[model samples]
Target: MKLNERSVAHYATSDSPADHTGFLRLWGGLGTPPTAGGAGRRCWFVLKGNLLFSFESPEGRAPLSLVVLEGCTVELAEAPVPEEFAFAIRFDAPGVRPYLLAADGPAAQEAWVKVLSRASFSYMRLVVRELESQLRDARQSLALHRRSPWKAGATGRSKPQASEHSSRLENGHSPSKDCSPGGSVEGRGSRLSGWASAEWELPGPASLLLGRGQSPVSPETSCFSTLHDWYGQEILELRRRWLQRAQGGRPARENKDRP
Candidate 1:
């Protein structure tokens, strides 16, 4: 957790490993070819909470790199593992190459997978919650805009005209008449309320980011593209629906199938 900076001498001479109080340490190789020098160099991995950190040795005194296990996709290696990699699991980190980690054995591999899965779920939930909160704020803003007095009108003026019902209320119209005072406001309110209640029923942009058919092993890079596309479409659809309702209290026929 400290992540203190250390000099070369400090790294070479010091061997102060973390207590790993709530950490699970697994011995594994970083990778090969690019990391050939560290290959077979028996590194110590400590997974604490949602983060996984590696050390040069088991004590975890020599800090290597740390990875936040959020937005990462995991999958079994499509290619067969070589003899050296009898227990291997692949992870596709965002904006990075697909790195292969060779676990010590089957037990280690399973443990790593379990921890990573939990981390991924936690991360996803956090992202989705944040997105939902943002969406709620956006809906509130849209409602405010709809209720603005400066909304467009045929009178060529920003100030909106009082509805007949509102004028009736102000002039103390007889309640016995067929048209009740404030009827227009009440009817519009009811319609808007119904629409507001249905807002939550629609799938949010974040929920649609990862398609229903997306594989657990799908690359994060591709998922981003899908998410952007889905998000854009959802925004456009929402704007179009809002415009129609504001214009004539009905959805546009062109986008009838969208919602």
Candidate 2:
């Protein structure tokens, strides 16, 4: 395949971090079979991302060869010269001869094999996609957690307001009439006091345990606890009114009846 020599030359000389770099013995010409009795040449090999570049020396600005480490496998191979630590990069393409290379030692051979095996664009893309999926799931979990308190507060407040309105209707009073000027000041004050009491009592353990500045929902005070407190307050108010009637004291209805 024809490569853009200018781009390849720029990348070869770029200061970008390399994945692996070392001097290795390269056998034969690029894509050609090994010669009958010729020894391999030791060249400076640099692996930057998926592109492998070989230079005449470590400081060489020009690259002698370029190998795209895609659709390829790196495996241990027996070199022509015995005692040489060798490996071959075999590509999947037809009529493409494998690139035979020998490292200086066993450690270098193993390291080159490991790095080359993972140096494909496909492998890097897979890693990126996995990380993105994990990030998305984390964001979703955080959004749900943030909305939980507001949802619970809305549900808790709605139930109490509905029950309060129903109780007023059963007692022969209109919600609109509660705001009228004809109502006694004492009655209005008492109603306001009840509302204040309920409002104060709504936060329950959140206020007591976490202090006034803390949020209304705490670990100790969940939606269940808030609903329980509201219902409990209603029961207490009903019992108090019943006791006042039994004692023959003036009930709140008498205030509306008076001039």
Candidate 3:
């Protein structure tokens, strides 16, 4: 219906009657239909539904009588036309043979062709929009159901008890019931690796006992090694004294000879 107004504005002069039920009358020079001998004279054109109608104006009285065209199809002209006529549009319909109609100007021809073509396709557009709306609603319903929690009581089954973690929190106890003296499973790897890394990074003096560097003989090794060796010798000497006391302080050669 909106296309009717556009067609009238572009193709019709100041005086023309138009509506939705009746055909839209556009004044233009009519070319000869395929059955005609030569180019036709100026006339008025109208399109109602799938039919096209042409009317010739009588000299004194209003135009009457109608030539109806059906299975109507409209298209723009491929080549340029004579100057006497503006740009042309070709109409091919079922009952009638194809004919070339000339508009008053090129702009008018373009508007007539575009508006009519779009009008034909508008119904398909509405159907597509309705389908898209239904599809969107279906997806929203599915997602809402998926995100909602299930109601177990609806199945006539008793509800599950709270997990240990939830029970601990409810009773004001820490939620680490399964944790050992060390830590939780998630943190164990990081904790062990951190302790080993810190142990390796101890001061040079502590490296000797930990055996972190190359060898104990390295000159650049910690000076604490000398103290460590002194303590080692003192420990060996005290052990020898204790063993001698256990043996009643007997001389080694005397004991061997007696045995």
Candidate 4:
């Protein structure tokens, strides 16, 4: 049951009441979830199982139903809408979220929003957790080669590590010492760039740059190399843990392969 004053939206699959229209008629702003809150109206229409979840609300507010389906979209035409009812996936989250598809007034909307918000929150956490798992695996693969270059000598790795991009980093390579042009590598990246960033102290971009005498080349080049090497190690370590976990956290697996 939806409210009379407020219009609820949904994917085509949802069971909208006979009085309510299943087809969406929008006025503006939608496609994907906003990276951050922004101005203007934005909405997300999702199809889950047989239910169509049309998630909307003010952007960036508390009780945020900030998580939803990431999918391809179909746009709709603009129409007259309530000023406060505009969908916001921009800079803000929805207010008192998880508003339902029931036919009721403000109270129903409030209850529905809360219910859905909690569900979305849970999902958001899972995604973050999954990321942690993958990163751990990639980091470990990198470390194995780093510690025993001779064993991994058959595997070729020549390029510097991409600080944030683990997929591109070499998993099979010589040890870190062998790759060194000479000296300590200090890698710095914003701790805030990923799931942990929001919860941790992120180093500035300059942290990725070389500091003091830690230079084998020009300051700019040295900084780049140092950052690269530092991040390279981090990548290895993270992947190492991930791989260990995947293999069931066994010490024996750590010693296997590459030779």
Candidate 5:
């Protein structure tokens, strides 16, 4: 392929549009570097076994290429330029930065393990705690309001004490809709409604962004195989818990609330 003095074109956009992400397969082989030369020019490193890595663009884009660094771990689809991409190249590329350095094998491995473990445990605790607390609160509310707090089954379906300036205009007691996560409610009539409504509200925005801010910048690279087994097991546990939650918190149809 030939650049033929045609400069590489670059598009500047904040978020990538999903459909246009497959621009790498456009090349059959290495094209000439987009840069002519110098301190921050583009160049091609190597291409073999369907691994077409570039040194000028973000795998296959423009506007941010002193040198595009692209590589495909998986061949058929487009290669992924990881978030640590530029950092990896700057250290490994020899010329990107004079003072940059790569760590030894063991150090790099330890760094990656530390980062992945932190993420796994953080998410594990967050998700587990949320579900556990919600279940506890709902159960407690039911226990408290099982029949009637002040009286026995002799009252049958009685309401809690009422007031003229009460939050519950329709019912004789305050509404349990706003009890939130673990706040117990007491009243037989709205017990089911309280739990259903709370669960409905709980799961939607209960998100926990595991690794916030920027991506990990250890400057050291290591293959993830060492932590893969533990990561995989934890992921399976999270998935199983999520599935159970989905079944448990399924929304009720208004029409089906009859019985």
Candidate 6:
């Protein structure tokens, strides 16, 4: 494949931080068969984000070879000389011979293997996607935490009104008396008692099912069964109250006896 040799040369000389740079012994000249008996030539290798370049010397401005680290695997290999810390970059393409290289020591050999193995565009993309997902989740959690205080403040504001109504009921006063038309005091008291019994007598089963501080299921869930059951309970409670009023029985006496 044709490469932009001028751009490659410029990048080799650029001040960008190299992923890894060191002297590694090359087993053969680029595009040549390996020699069996010769000690390999040591060259300066620079790895820059999936591109491995070889230079004649550390100060060389030109790149002797460029190996694109894609569709390839780095594996520990036996070198021509015994005890040489050797590794090879083996490509999957047909008729392409593996590039044999030897690091100066065992530590360097392992480091080179690790860096080369991970030096692929696909691997970098995978890591980026994983990080993005984690960041999105973190942002969602922060938003929920931020909204919690506003919900608490709203609940706090409503409490005083509820307390005032409850105190009026306890003091034998009707909460709706101010707006209600004038009538006999006994008649007004009975009407207020009946109104409170129907409206505020029992807490809904949905609130009981969800304990304090727990949010109710969202309407957007499309959970029709739960919604039906909740409303069914409410219908049953209203029906029972209607039957009591029809029979001329007052539930106020029963409610007043409760703790």
TM-score, candidate number 3 = 0.29
Clashes of each: 0, 0, 0, 42, 7, 0
Alpha carbon lDDT at 79, candidate 1 = 23
Roughly what TM-score does model 5 have, to 2 decimal places? 0.17
CA error at residue 194 for candidate 4, angstroms: 18
The C-alpha stretches of model 3 lying farther than 4 A from their native spots are 1-39, 57-73, 78-81, 84-96, 119-259
Scored by TM-score, the top model is 6
Pitting candidate 2 against candidate 4, the one with the higher TM-score is 2
Candidate 1 lDDT at 68 equals 55
TM-scores of the models, in the order given:
0.34, 0.55, 0.29, 0.21, 0.17, 0.56
Which one wins by lDDT: 1 or 4? 1
lDDT score for residue 70 of model 6: 74
- Model 3 clash pairs? none
- For candidate 5, the lDDT comes to 0.28
Tens-digit lDDT track of model 6 for 1-259 = 7778898889978999899999998886367466667568889999999899999999997988899887676667878998788888877678888888999987888778767766765445334433433443464365456543233223433454345434324432222332121222231112222221211223422223233543333232126685466446545655775576588794675445433
- Per residue, candidate 1 scores C-alpha lDDT tens digits across 12-91 of 33444422322232224243343333344445666555555666665645557565555454433322334332222234
Model 1 ranges off by over 4 Å: 1-40, 78-81, 84-95, 121-259
List pairs with backbone clashes in candidate 6: none
Question: Which candidate, 2 or 6, has the higher TM-score?
Answer: 6
Task: Point out the worst 10-residue segment of candidate 2 by lDDT.
Answer: 187-196
- The CA-based lDDT of model 3 is what? 0.35
Models ranked on TM-score: 6, 2, 1, 3, 4, 5
Candidate 4 regions exceeding 4 Å error are: 1-11, 14-115, 118-133, 136-162, 165-259
The lDDT for every candidate, in the order shown, is: 0.40, 0.61, 0.35, 0.31, 0.28, 0.61
Instruction: List RMSD in Å for every model shown.
Output: 22.4, 28.8, 40.0, 19.4, 23.9, 29.5
